[model samples]
Target chain A: MAEKIKPPRIRVSRRIKKNKVFKVKVKFDHPSFTGLAMADDTTEPVFNRAKPVTFIRNMLVYYGDELVSRLSLSSGIADDPLFTFKLKATKEAPVKIVFIDNFGKRWEASKEIKFKG
Target chain B: MVGGLTIPLLSVIPSSNDAHGAVFQTPKDLENLTELERIHLPKISLPPVVEDGASASIVCSVDHPMDEDHYIKSIQIMNFADPIVIKGKFFLTPVNGEAYLSTQIRLSGGEGTVWVIAECNKHGKWAASKKVTVAAGGC
Candidate 1:
């Protein structure tokens, strides 16, 4: 349970394409929370991470209103992760990429993709 | 017994940063690594000399098919000088038709080697590294 949601830096290599399988890289910054242990009656640490952990949970990508892909992530992912892939599109639309942290906080960013059909 | 000893050996890992060590970010972890001969390491693009503290985009690319059954699982960037070696990691699926990822990373002063490793979902792991010289002062 996160009380606050932090915005992340997102970048899309290009905003326009030729309606074919176009390659674009999606980059975002995320922190992984690591809980610390304390001795005493308390079993849980005061705050989960002595330092912010770079673990992220899931990434939901949307092409306009339609979902394009969903990626499940783990602490195995490094901090400030970058994902690159080719997009197959037929027309112009807005590409929305949402990063969901392990705490369930959601931050979203978007890019306008113009595919020359 | 081999079975009983193996369990303890696996748990007796070094007191390292297991919290965020992703995978092959250190030499100890690379001991018995799979030498993915067929998988080619990505082509890394960066300036010959990066100013210290200045943000520089480290682009890595590879020519691989991004099919549903066969695809690049993830990519990792590591630097030995960095306190935390893992600079970054990129995860991908078949939806993304190619294997490429670029991101900005700040380097400390002096010379260091940047290693790039990619893992294909079906295949093992492939790696490549580049020697970078960070200028004395960050611009």
Candidate 2:
């Protein structure tokens, strides 16, 4: 069974204008473990094999049905990683973000891109 | 006697400082790299100048296919003068918007060259460097 994953949170700027660039921020509540660090219980820094390496393997951003951006991630990203990027909002549509962890858990969220008239 | 001798010693040491203005600089002799390796080199974008304490938005990408068998493994952002040169590393895949990343980095040194190095799983490392300076503190 896939691990329990939290829903991804997406935020689009409110003061966006048509044909203008706007910011989109997405945050995921997940642990990105490299599984190379020592366990907290260990006295010395040693590779901990008890836990498996897991991270957000893939992140996709979509404007309505069209794929606008995609980010393939690794354990290099920290836990609860927050990413910010820009998109030119040409129309009012839902900006969706989907994240798939290395363990195959899928999480997603969306926010409407309402441009300022 | 001491002052005169020191002057000659200083002059004998080559000035390693860059004389050119703020600009992104990369190795000129890229012909040595295989055509495929040259294609994997990172293309970095950033402002030439920024406020002393402001963050500089950086975008790096490579014009290469991210195939499963041969893809860009990671993009590393490094500061030439930072005690810890490696700022961050982003691993990518075919789904990663054409192996692109947009983020901001503070040139804590106030003025210096920042580098973005991209590594392909099969092609090794390709790097690009950009120089940024604080307002009024031109490099």
TM-score of chain B of each: 0.68, 0.68
Worst 10 residues of 2 chain A by lDDT: A38-47
List, residue by residue over A1-117, the lDDT tens digit for candidate 2.
245556877776669888676767776767665545334535543234555776677887778887866665655444555676556666788988888888787888999978776
Candidate closest to the true structure, highest DockQ: 1
> What are the Cα lDDT values of the candidates?
0.56, 0.61
Which residue pairs in candidate 2 have backbone atoms (N, alpha carbon, C) closer than 3 angstroms, thus clashing? none
Model 1 scores a C-alpha lDDT of 0.56
Q: Write the residue-wise lDDT of candidate 2 on B17-52 in tens digits.
A: 232443422344554645664567677776666564
How many backbone clashes are present in model 2?
0
Off by over 4 Å in 2: A1-4, A38-50, B1-126, B129-139
* Model 1 agreement with the true structure over B1-139: per-residue lDDT tens digits: 0011110111111223222334443323433423443334455676667664335457676667777788787777777664345655666666555666545564555777767777777765666667778775221
Docking class of 2: incorrect
Quote the lDDT for B46 in model 2: 63
